[model samples]
Target: MPAERLDKILAHHGFGTRKDVKRLCHKGLVFLNGKIATDPAVKVDIGSDTLVIDGKKITLQHDLYIMLNKCRDVVCANRDGEHQTVFDLLDESLKHKFLGGDLHCMGRLDIDTEGLLILTTDGKLTHSLLSPKTHVPKTYGVGLRDALSEEEKLRYAETFSKGFWIDREQNEDGFNCAPAVLKWREKDGKFTLEGENPALYEAVEKNSSGKSDCLLTIFEGKFHQVKRMFAQMGNQVVYLKRVKMGELSLDPQLEPGSYRELSEAEIALLKQRQTD
Candidate 1:
């Protein structure tokens, strides 16, 4: 990418328009590479140069690939009339300033669901990731209302590995979903082993009133698939959060409702296909 003006970078980060940037510059409020800034028109290296305003880091990237930590109550659509959308987590700066147009959400998550969501301007990448033929894996952290017995967990894992029948009432595709993977999790969605893991059903049985948690990975995109899959097993998902998509994992440092630009290495991981 080519070099960009300092004020433009600030404006692209939602610091304000060029005029506002000039004001900040004149007040000695802008700092470039730890030095006080006096000029707003100075050119900057988008990747190497760091810009700080009021002690906040300003990121300026020409190729935008955002990893948003979505929170509950937000829809995944580009626009929504009933509730907030994922893009709403971004500032007005990214829309028209940095990015030329609206950012597209690669995969859609339910309104009540939260966690990792990829937003990019690359159409081809989006097509490749979302296409059903690609069979890209998406992993979710799940919380169930009832504690699943050891047998039930085994059955669930087996059912996921082999294509299973969706309750006909929920889906009429006439074909079963592709094989998926399921694993146990602690209450906070951290991974644990099957036998050595105390968070498994065996531990839940001791309390008798605790909810069970697990991690689920699927290759297909179906409406209410994860929630409904468990429902068929006489279990209910009280909470759902997507933790991984394709080869990208949500950054733990990013808090809910916050987002960060994907590093170049992370971007490459998304395009790397798995081989058997």
Candidate 2:
């Protein structure tokens, strides 16, 4: 979004190599502001400059952001033993690029959990997203092991929106948490898991696994926070999947183990969430 070398901008936009851009510049094929650019090294304001190559405009893309639809049996850590990690779900090319850049996750889901995850080399963005001050809400699609009565569901909903206190392991005393947004959906389906819990995965659909599903958006990320909340409600979480984080949702097209690059607009949305 700042001023940069014309050729570098063009190359970054995937127009061509720097050498190719130089050739085009010299051949009067590249135009900027109705004038032919003779030097590829010319400085241009990418945010305002109108760049045309072979009679077409180009927009330059910056940075690399990834959206991963995480699945079970994979850890969120950089490296773990005897279990797959989120990085393993990436394409080899992405893995290499990310590792070389020292990319990291903004937040982590448990190895048995699945859903939306943002992986990036942008440290500032990652930190901002993870910061408590930002209060970026993360939404999860949860599967419960118990059914609740209408009266109980109302109590749970009221508790979720009004906030509550929960017990902690580190201290006998507990902490008060901010209210979260929740959407409930009753289900009679079986869960599908990889290696973490096979029995839950093997159960037949609509065969009374006795589970309820809900979508929850929490503003905080404590260790096993969602599980604790459900436990406090006298319910057990049998399966968990993250569906959204900030303004980014899990790409519906992506399979459990697949991932894809985020668009420039998507990146903007995420940054907006931090400041909003």
Candidate 1 lDDT (Cα, whole model)? Answer: 0.76
TM-score of each: 0.68, 0.68
lDDT, candidate 1, residue 97?
Answer: 42
What C-alpha lDDT do the candidate models reach, one value each? Answer: 0.76, 0.73
Quote the positional error of residue 169 for candidate 2 in Å: 2.9
Tens digit of per-residue lDDT, candidate 2, span 1-276? 557788877765555689989989988989998899998999887557788998987654345688887878899988888898898777664543321145678688888887678888877788778888888887776778887777887789899999998888565446676898766664434333323223222221122233336667799988888988888888889988776677666666677778888888888979996642
Candidate 2 error regions (>4 Å) = 1-62, 97-100, 170-173, 186-212
Candidate 2, poorest ten consecutive residues by summed lDDT: 199-208
lDDT of 2 at 63: 50
Candidate 1 has its poorest 10 consecutive residues by lDDT at 200-209
Question: How does model 1 score by TM-score?
Answer: 0.68
